[model samples]
Target: MTEGPPSILSLAWLLSLVYVFVAAVFVVRRLTDKSGKELARRIKAATRGRDAATDAAGDLVKRHEMSGLRWLDVFLSRQAWSRRMDKMLAQADIEAPLGIFVLLSLVLATTGYVAASLYAQNPFVRLAVGIGLGLLPFKWIAMRKARRMQEFERQLPEALELVGRALRAGHTFTSGMGMVVSEFAEPIRGEFQTTMEEINFGMGVAVALDNLMDRVDCPDLNFFVVSVKIQNETGGNLAEIVGNIAWLIRERLKLKGRIRVLSAEGRMAAWVLCLLPFFVCGAVQVLNPGYLNLLFTAPLGHILIYLVMGLMTMGILVIRKMVRIEV
Candidate 1:
């Protein structure tokens, strides 16, 4: 008969007000900044003699605002949202503003909270679930980004082989990359196409490659960077160096695939074991009602459950470590 702590509507209103205040301060500082003005001027200058796409790009950069919350930005840098956005953008071929993602994150958090609240039987349990849901998308995005990076790494040697052949045939790096865009398919082609444009717009090859590496964070790209850097420094046959690098990468990728195959069963077992307790508890509470109520209904039961969860989590990690082979 007791009322819930507060409706989700109330929580949303509080969050909305805080977001508005933060946004307003951000806007105010941006409006007063000479740095923003200088950057805008530079973009205008860069795109002045260019075509419609370049002009649109200039406008997009000028309008793309990321100000305030420097602390949060730094913290999230450790969390890797930029890397996630990069892969998502490349895959989806979406050119929408980054702010759209910020909004999407909030919406995702709310959906998490609502889903948790509906499934959880107790107010305290529901609150805990809601908080977890709120942070779920960030973790989800990180996992998605990692998977995409793995895929990209697996495909990189092939892309490099294509580029190496084109470069040896007397094509400039930019043109060679454009060849990649035309000849290859999604992900590699799309990412290279963007890099090609960035290079055309006055960005240096090294800088563009670094930017691309930042997006993927793949180990294969690290080797490619090393090859390029060495070629730039020592004046060797760049094509030969790239071809050798591609061979090494392909071997590494093959090894990684075999290791993954060997580890799959262990990883699945760890996942199931870790998840089983929570699912069983949830199902029991839903079906029998009183069966698992004692856990939350008593302090001792709550502490015992928490201890069990901690142990189970530790055990899962141990199994995960056993199966994880870093190549």
Candidate 2:
């Protein structure tokens, strides 16, 4: 039996919607794929080098391992984020920075607002919470990046010493770096390997070194770069200079570690103090919902809550700053 006209019309409408949905999915995938390819090209182009041929190709492959919305890259500086991003990117060898992260944050914020309006009993509060939650991923990414970079900085002197020994024993600077790249763990190995590869792709050694320092953006790395640059310019004993710098870095790392150990209790105390008030309020809400009804529903109560939140946020920042010991 032939289908009726209404059945045909309904089928046509359903097919149209399906086609539209499929088209959207394909377009999104195509765009993301194109963007990935472009980022890979940029990384390879920028990280070229001589003798080692270390391009961003390998690093780019590593970067794709992350969930793509790492919060750590947002709040941290390029120095910290680059190291963390490098780890994530290195896993997948992704050559791009965290541009996709920013996009994800905005999308999350939008999603939170929409979800809150549709499902939350109190839209404004839920929306605010959603935005805060959306910001959380970036913060996490930043912290991870900071910690990783700190670890790298702490170990940099040791790696430098290894390279210096190799250089003194008659290895070329490039070969010494290659040894470090192979022997040292990430992020030192990963970073040096990338630099070595870039240099191998025909970039000048000085420029490649500068690029590495730029990406690292650590004062420790900067010091090494300065020594290298000066040695190149004035014709000094490069290995000896690097060796001394390595010693200084080790001393600094030791001092910083001691300070961190001493300040551990204070840091822990600050975190607890900062979080206590929120914990109490959340408990009260759960135990006596009516007792806290005004906090969300009343205009005056909402304002007060915001004021309190602002103050709490400021207090946390102050405590964090007080506890932070810059080495």
Candidate 3:
């Protein structure tokens, strides 16, 4: 017998092709990657040392600038959805092209739709599952962004203190930022590094700071930036101001920690209540698949399942709202 066009084998092939394409793109990118800034730094060194070999290497880098998946960028640049995804990716410090991410999402959604349509035999369920699966990449990006922001928050006070110390040691503001870039761990270090580069690239202090604030999306960073700008304008002691901001951040962080601890029980209860039904249903299904098959076969069973799912969703949202205490 001949196989149909939309057989399992064909779907698997399609999924494999997508994965192969993604892997090839990323692997090639990694293999060919060069550091644009590093090359510039080397060119400066070569000029200072008057070395012909170093100049040649730096010139080669300039000639062959590092390339990314710019085709996707060109194609998706006009779309609003792609723009929003780009912003999210920027905040998350993701270096992948938005087009590539969207392509992966499309492939996953297509696979999910095909597979679920075959197994679930319900159009609504297939659509829902497909969309949810498609959004998994974005969900991952959001989680990464949240984690980076949390780490930034944890490190911001210490970074500020270091910057203040650098200023007190009679360094310029840019030099102080360089100190943070050198002393701090990741996320914030990268932020300061970018800002320093921006300033070096002819951007003003206010503009570079605004860019930093835009990239990080942290209010505490906003406070620090604004304080620095104000101190710069008014000719006050910037070192003292930044130190005070650091101390203030410490106190606010302490209060926020207390609030989080106090709300831990509510969060735990919310999670338990939200996931209990699914866990019980899974247990029952494991015990007897035939028991849940009735829900797929009977009209009344569909109604009950729909009602229960709706109520569970509402309960989850309510609990989310109740437990989310913003500082």
Candidate 4:
């Protein structure tokens, strides 16, 4: 059964709801950024005769760390899931609460399920649609985190060079790390700041660096951490070591880029092959609804849809395998 376009009223209601949701988001962001604390801080500052600049300087240390426990942990019975979500959100630079993100996912999933249910008469299909839609927020965050990590990887060699230069200039290791924090941009800056904070709070250098590796999960960073740890124990020229590591990573990235360029044609062809069937089928359905309806009316048509989906999945996997080049 073909569904017609949504009614104007329904569209208008959706738009209004979206607007409300967006406004709520802004309100939440403002609260999260310590807006309420600002007044209290200002009054205290006035009493103590602290400067506005001092209050503003607090911005560097101020961040939205989830206070107390979340209800999600009660149902899940594990702090692990909450911690994982927090890590992913940090990696993606998302400045929202975990609960808020979960709520947003639920809303999107409900919307998608309703839309899918109109077209799909099957109960299983509706459930599947809801589940898939529910994962969209997580998928979006994961994609964002992946992109951020890639960007971090790109910035790393230069960041390493800066750190190495700082060390060569006779700075302490912590001071050199601080120089990276000041000189480079986030997420490198934020990451280093977090590490420095941990150190200032009495965490050992090795442990703090390990936490850094866990959060960033970059191979080049792994080298940095390991080299630093080994050097602290074994004693060596750390600046030259870091510089060499940075040079190696640059060469590796260059080779990876060359591989990507070489495989570009194959990747394009794969995309076309995967998408052409869907495009042709959609055009045919629009032009000749009756002709396309015959397939839907027949039991064999359902089987064909499943078969096509399976084939497409296999083809996509094969193409991915072909194009993937590890550096």
Candidate 5:
């Protein structure tokens, strides 16, 4: 007897297997690529001590590509949004190419769409799942960027104090920055190192500092950059200025810590409030599977669901805004 036509579930599984195979091949190719190794070597060499003037005078110009794939990179280069995405990736300190992230998002979206199709009969639910999955990559990048910025902020005061000490010990500003680069850990070290490299690569101190500020998302870093710019124009004891800024940052951080401690209960309550509905819904689904079937099946229930989701989203945003005190 011949086999019957494959079901949607079987088709989905077939597609998932194909996707996994393609992803594995891509990963293997990426791992074994010679160009990636060459780029790594170049980056390592660039970070080593070298004659800045000679390197700056070299005819070699570095190309900033958005993606590893040439065609995708070319396409992304023409799009303004791609540049913003690239900046976000840089801020997140992700070494992966933009193409990889875009591809991952597409794969996730496709997978989610297929998976949702197996269970969710509603087209809107399937589309929502796909869109939500597509957004995951960007959400991850945003979270990473936020975490990195927080770490950078935490490291800023110590780095500033170190630079101030270096200045007081008769070192030049660039040398002081180099000291911070060598002494500290990432992402502050990486940021300062990039600033130093830019300065060395024929960029002016003020321009380099401005670029640094643009790259980093920390507000405390702005104080350091502004102070440096002001000191550069009108001569003052730079060491003392840096020290004062460092002290101010430390005090602000201390106040922020205290505020966080005080607001801990509110934050916890916000989390509980946000999660309680989902927990109840999940528990009900487990205890009485078809009890809430109307919510998914009926038009009025769908409208109510959407309205409730919107309100919940607004509430979450408001709660986040309330808890987040800018120091």
Candidate 6:
């Protein structure tokens, strides 16, 4: 007797497993690959469009591609939103192509819809799951960007003090930044190294600093860049100025920490409030299996569920705004 062909569900599961394995491998390679080959490739691609005339003139400003595929790169280049996404990826230090993320999101959304259909018969529930899963990539990007910016801000004061010491030791400003590149760890080191490379490649100090500011969304970094630009114009005691800025940044960080500590209660309350409804719903389902069946089976129940969800979202936003004190 011959075996029957696999069911559609089995095929879907198999495909999902393969996709997950491939994505995991890709992520691991991206995280561990430190050969700088990718960076070199991007630099080469960026410079490929420049003429020798521009090269000779030392105008080596390169336009980076958003995707590996020529068509996708061209399409992304034309879209403002894609450019913003590219910048967000850069801020997060993610080296993956934008097209990969776009494709991944679509795949995830489709997978989510299929998975939801296995347990949920409502179209709205399936759509909601799909949208939620589709947003995971972007949400992850945002979280990564936030963590990186926080780390950068945390390192800025020490990096600045190091630069200040180098300046006082009679090194040029660029030399001070180079020292930072050599001495500091990731994020700070990478950023400074990029700025140094840009300067070496004929980009002006101010313009390079501006680019750095664009790449980092830290207000404290804005202060450093503005101070450097001002000092270059006015011929001040650069070392003293840097030291003062470092001190100011350190104090502000301390104050921000204290503010977070004080608002800890509010943050905790917001979290509990956000999670309570889901916990209750889950408990109700477990305690009495069909008690909440109407919510999934009836139109009126669906309307109520949506309204409750909308109100919960509004409450969460308001609570977040109340607790988030900008320092």
Number of the top-ranking candidate, with TM-score as the measure: 6
User: lDDT tens digits, residues 1-327, model 1?
Assistant: 966666779778766865775466557555544556656766766666567556656675544433234543344445566646645654444443333355445655565566566556666676666567656655665666667676677678888898899889998767778887888876677778878888897998788888887666677788888778667777888888889999999998889899999999999999889888879888988989888767776989978977997898799889978998899
Query: What TM-score would each prediction reach against the true structure?
Result: 0.68, 0.69, 0.80, 0.80, 0.82, 0.83
Stretches of candidate 3 above 4 Å error?
1-75
Q: List the residue pairs that clash in candidate 4.
A: none
Candidate 3 clashing pairs, residues 3+ apart or interchain: none
| Superposed model 5: Cα runs more than 4 Å off | 1-18, 21-63
Q: What is residue 78's positional error in candidate 3, in angstroms?
A: 1.5
Per-residue lDDT tens digits for candidate 2, residues 1-327, read: 954344557556655664565455445544545456757676667666532233455655555432333444334334665556555543333444454454456556765565455445676667796788678656766666677678688779888998899889999889989999888888788889888998897888889998787666468998898888888888988789889999999898889889888889888988788789879989998998789877767989979987987897888788788778897
Model 4, which residues run further than 4 Å from truth? 1-6, 11-70, 76-80
| Model 4 TM-score (2 dp) | 0.80
Comparing 4 and 6 by lDDT, which wins? Answer: 6
lDDT against the true structure, per candidate, is 0.71, 0.72, 0.82, 0.80, 0.86, 0.86
Model 5 backbone overlap count: 0
The TM-score of candidate 3 is 0.80
Alpha-carbon deviation at 16 in model 3, angstroms: 3.1
User: How far does residue 30 in candidate 3 sit from its true spot (Å)?
Assistant: 9.3
Once fitted onto the true fold, the runs of candidate 1 whose alpha carbons sit more than 4 angstroms away are 1-63, 66-124, 170-172, 278-289
Please estimate how well model 2 matches the true structure, expressed as its whole-model Cα lDDT: 0.72
What tens-digit string does per-residue lDDT give for candidate 4 at 1-327?
A: 967877879867875786688568657655555546766765667676556646654752353344312344244335677678878887888876676667667777776677677677777688888889888888998999999899889988998888889889999888888988988987888999999999997789999999999888678788889999999999999999989988988988899899999999989989899989989989998998777886766889888888988999999999999999887
Which of the predicted structures, 2 or 6, would earn the higher TM-score when compared with the native?
Answer: 6
Off by over 4 Å in 6: 1-14, 17-63
